[model samples]
Target: MHRSAPRLSRILACAAVPVMLVAVGCSSDSGSDGKKNAGSSSSGTASSKPSEPTVEPAKFTDLPDPCTSIGKKTIEDLVPEAKKKGGTAGGSTDLSVRGSCSWNGLDDQGVKGSQYHWMDVGFTRFDSDQALGSGAKRATEDYGKQVTKTKATEGAKKAAAEPAAGIGEEATLVTYGLSKTDEDFVYATVVARTGNVVVTLTYNGAGYAGAKTPSSGDIVKGAQKAIKEAIASVEKTAGADASSPAKDDAKTDAEDTKKDDADAKGDAGSEDSPKSKATPKS
Candidate 1:
């Protein structure tokens, strides 16, 4: 019986071997599953990495000076006998981002009375923003606002807005008639957008004494001419100013060379000797 018991125990041990083998097989499967899950998790993390948002870049980075935005001839034609021929600059904290100039004049014709004219040009520049959008887009928004504001002028009559061509990328002409100083005044405002800049020009005229009020068509034409010139000036000034530093540097070098030559001549003339004068050390 003891021998049988021993044999039975050995049989049971043999049976346990299958269970151990099964356990080992399950462990190997579990390890393989764990590696597979780890690979999947790593791939998911890589894919979940966030990407940065991007926006369109701005076009124009600088603005033209407003005081000289229009040609001298144009100013004379628009505001004859202007009080300030050079145009009075408007108040601005930053001339680079915003600027304006204005002119007013009375052209007297003696018995024929006098004609009064006033003109002003303004510029506003915008920069690109991820939240606000592109510079051009912002300028476009301001362009519309300017038009609306001009149309809502106090005491304005028959205010009208029409698209103006040959001015810039986009333009609007706002015209209205106002009465002031017991005379009818004709006003024409041109709001134009070029790239990231907004150009607003207001031209108004009235007749004093026996003279007749300026025609709306004439005022509109004048405003268009002046605004076109002002817009063109922005491009011209930007190009010229971009290279102004280099030109200034070259001019400075030339002046330095001329001074050096003068100094050499002065030194040579001082002694009329073959020996050189030692430069005094500081």
Candidate 2:
């Protein structure tokens, strides 16, 4: 009976070895599957990352030359016009007008920037009774108010000067100027007239240095020229003689009415006109 008990113990030990082997094999398979899934998740995360946005650079060829298009009239025209209207046009750089033109500049970091330049012109007509004085007064007041409002803003460091008088009540020209804020860059020049005519020259870029911001005084100069050309165009379309016919006619009618009343008082024989008479008796 003792020998049979020893043989039974050895059989049980042999069966335990296979059970342990099976458990080890199952654990190995589970670990291999987990690794494969982790690798796949890592790869997917990498693929899902987003790319940065791209910025397009401005081309210099996009702008027109103000000199050839606008002719001799340029922002320089403002000098004499302003003086004539008892106003002054003064700034650090001498401006020159050019054709549709674009250029590149640089920023503090040496990053490339771009500029667009353009011109706008406008005009308005008033009767002789309106008085050039009245028109000039309105323009000066409006320009002052605009400058005040602009200076009140937080980021705007400077305010534009009041516009100078142009060619009297028959025509007035104003210029709009834009430049890059990050670096000293010139953007564009727009000219606006009283009667709602406008011409604009635009320049755009990444930084001022790229457009040679320090050197390209063209932005202001071009604007001046465009404004002059626009003013000239407006004058051509609405000649001085015909510019304020409405106001002149109104003034003439008022004077005629005064003269007629004086004459009627002097001559009792003259009866009141039907248009001016009260309603007839029933």
Best by TM-score: 1
TM-score of each: 0.70, 0.30
lDDT for model 2 comes to: 0.41
lDDT of 2 by residue, 102-133 (tens): 22222234354433222222222222223333
TM-score of 2: 0.30
- Candidate 1 lDDT tens digits, 1-282: 778998999999999999999999999999999999999999998889676586556556676777788889988998999999999999999887899999999999899999999999999988889888888899999999998898898899999999998889999999999999999999999999998889999999999989989999999999999999899887765432243578989999999999999998888767656455566799
Question: Alpha-carbon error at 134 in model 2, in Å?
Answer: 5.0
Error of 1 at 196 (Å): 0.9
The count of residue-pair clashes in candidate 1 stands at 0
Candidate 1 at residue 240, lDDT? 27
